[model samples]
Target: MQQTCVIGAALASCLAAGTALAQDDATLAAVEARGVLACGVNAGLAGFATVDSNGVWSGFEVEFCRALAAAILGDPALVDFHALPADGRYRELVSDDVDVIARGGAWSIGPDVRRGLDLAAVSYFDQTGFLLPVELGVSSPKELDGARICLVDDMATGPALDDYFHAAGIAWQPVAATGDSEARSLYLAGDCDAYARPAAELSAVRATFETPLAHVIVSDGSSRVPSGPVVREGDDSWANVVRWTFNALLAGEELGITSANVREMAATPSSNPEVNRLLGTEGEIGAMLGLPQDWAVDALAAGGNYGEIFERNIGENTPIGLARGLNALWAKGGLQYAAPFR
Candidate 1:
């Protein structure tokens, strides 16, 4: 797909200042003209983002990029995926190389305030964790005193691991690895006693290990982390489009809506007002976000709702196989909640 740079009236209202692009009307216009949504993501992360054998990008993060494209262009396939190395992703987004970032970048004050980026919904509730082989017989991270731990250097994971271990008064040696794969190899080869990374990510890696079941995750709650998408700050139009694109997915799940049922629900009248409005059977919700009246319908149809995406991507059926502990809908005792679409 060719790159178009059109930011229309809908986008103009949403773009905010101090964001990466800061509402360059021309840039947005250029995007629209190109007719494709440019997306940036990590080079490779098993459950997050990766290219498959057929050269198709697939993962939870990639689903989001497609969702946004479907919402904006009325066609989900209108997305141009740019797989970027970890070090190059932030720069790519800031320079307008991609419309948004769906890779698993953490939301922090530094990126929001300094990088001119705006973070959207927390799609995945994650936590940092340590993986030690069963042979180590370590019951907890606290037992890792004087142990050599391998982790990516200078990333958020290092500081988080340090702070948690420091507060516990645990002294350990840091064996800095250049990237996530390197860190895992160092630990797996006995170069280090443990490997540290996001719990879901670490679990995914361990699944590919020789004695996968022998790997143990530290049970501390402090490691839980949240991950989400990002766009240039100051573009309220772009931000809202991405933010509610996520919320709509959550709301669809809450309302028992799915891609299969949305079309039918849209045709028939129902007592539920929120459902009516969300499906564009009653309210102009899409107009508020500068999308077609059936935008939400299309977004949901592009993939399943948030819950569906969860189950398919990292949920029990997939290799990552994360249970919906904190990611469940608010009604079912999870943190996933959406603002009223009225």
Candidate 2:
């Protein structure tokens, strides 16, 4: 069954500092009424989102939808995953076809206020990069001059490629594909000399190749594309729920909470006051959002923490093999820092 996005923040001043969450969370109400979360995710980005032959969904973004289901519905399996295409994703979100959009699109400017969508916490810190077959011998993107490149017809990627190529004074023919999977097919069939997109995406497709080592990815780290879930603008009450759910994942990692241990941790409050507050063993944090007191517990227990989700879905051990490079905790010097639970 299809539901619609009605939830839809910020840090400190942007969240309006001490503004009160709305007394009635319309989005949450709608979700509860439907009994499932309608999440729109990438249709073919392997590690970010994917579907098995049995039609079961699993991936980094899939876990996020599940975690949200656990938080609001008390069941991780209650979510309905909607595979969205790049061209029409925002239209689907805006039309209320999906409750929230969970994809690789950046929560960047222009997309936010212009589209009346509010971007949530950063789920993955990504950049625009390149993938070239080993036979191409193009160690750097600059090395490819007048190369035919397979480009995905997405919002950020084409402009990024155009700007980079123009700046480097190199001209290339583009082999356009509608989506990632199509682009991968174009690359494998030698339709283009290289393919360009987020490096993590390239790695995911590369891993599925018959000979993974036959390709090399070239990246200048020239773009900062931090991605997260998105919802319609103006629903502070529901927005806070999404914001804090992501925060719970990050804070759980910082506080040493895990899916295997979240129940145990919630069984008895630790001496740490923050953990107690986050886990609802000592505060009305959930009540403030008009949710059950065990909200964070269920969210954390659904898919462990941000780190755990990363490692399990797209981390170094997986075929996607994405490192925690810019996504590490703030304490450890990366950009991922959760706002205080207090």
Candidate 3:
């Protein structure tokens, strides 16, 4: 009787462990079954994520979602975008309303650890900076003491701005704007002395102005915020997909692969081992992630390489005109470096 009881107990324990393992990948299974990758994006952040009058979504972050869908579903168009407001975006993810949040938000220790969220990667390195009229003749933030600043209320930029001023023993007043458009309007109307926001965003805002050269970005590296996509904690499979999809984008850029040439490059495998592995010519990276061997190819086809996406969306020729400062490849003294595929 005792031997029979021990065997039954061991069997039950094994079954419980198997159940836990299955639960770990529940999110991935659901995504596959749905056949559509639902991505949570910003309601309207010009260069990051925004919809046009025709309801077509196109932006830097939107491209990431399309790439994810292409890698997983083999079709970039098989994606459902949920426009989320800043305050409730995380909540929507936690409640399983969205599979992933690709809206670029600053990654901080507090949100990652306390909010039960995982920041997939630092897709964009943003510096907290101030934008004011070039006529102010202020080349530095320190010169803006007692300045009234227009800031977005929902982001961490407002607090970071306060920290900078308080630490410098300077006094300033903050005029909180509900969103980027409002902040820009407030600043342009002379309601605020300076507009405080991420440098990339400020650049985008400046470009929209009637006179682009009328404003200057004053940044001394007081605060550097690395922003990226977010996924629910405890789902390793889903997290890995999002992380590697971003890496593949970076690798494509590093290997000189672009949307226009990805198919040709994949057809004729490269002698470079890294390129071959990334393009699925040499190894089984895609299978390891439960995807096709040409997953990276599909992703790149959807959005082109990281550099290509940047140049197409927010680069020098675009209204944003943002140079690839820290976003440049690591070989060019930038922070974007992809891990080895092999």
- Clashing residue pairs in all predictions, respectively, total 30, 2, 0
Ranked by TM-score from best down, the candidates are 3, 2, 1
The estimated TM-scores of all candidates read 0.88, 0.89, 0.90
Q: Kindly provide the TM-score of model 1 when superposed on the true structure, using C-alpha atoms.
A: 0.88
Q: In the order shown, what is each candidate's alpha-carbon RMSD?
A: 6.1, 6.8, 3.4
| 2 or 3, greater by TM-score | 3
- Candidate 3 lDDT over residue span 1-342, tens digit each: 133323687888877766777866887788899999989987776677888889899989899999999999899998899998754468789899999999556777767888889998888998888999999999999998999998888678777887888899999999998777788889999999999878887887787789989889999987988888899888888889999999999999988999999999999988899899988998889988888889899999998999988998888888888889899999999999998898
User: What's the lDDT for residue 247 in model 3?
Assistant: 97
Candidate 3 lDDT trough over 10 residues, lowest sum:
1-10
Better of 1 and 2 by TM-score: 2
Tens digit per residue, CA lDDT, model 1, 192-237: 9888777777777777777788888875777657778888876767
lDDT of each: 0.79, 0.84, 0.87
- At residue 304, candidate 1 shows an lDDT of 75
Off by over 4 Å in 1: 1-30
Candidate 3's C-alpha runs over 4 A off are: 1-20
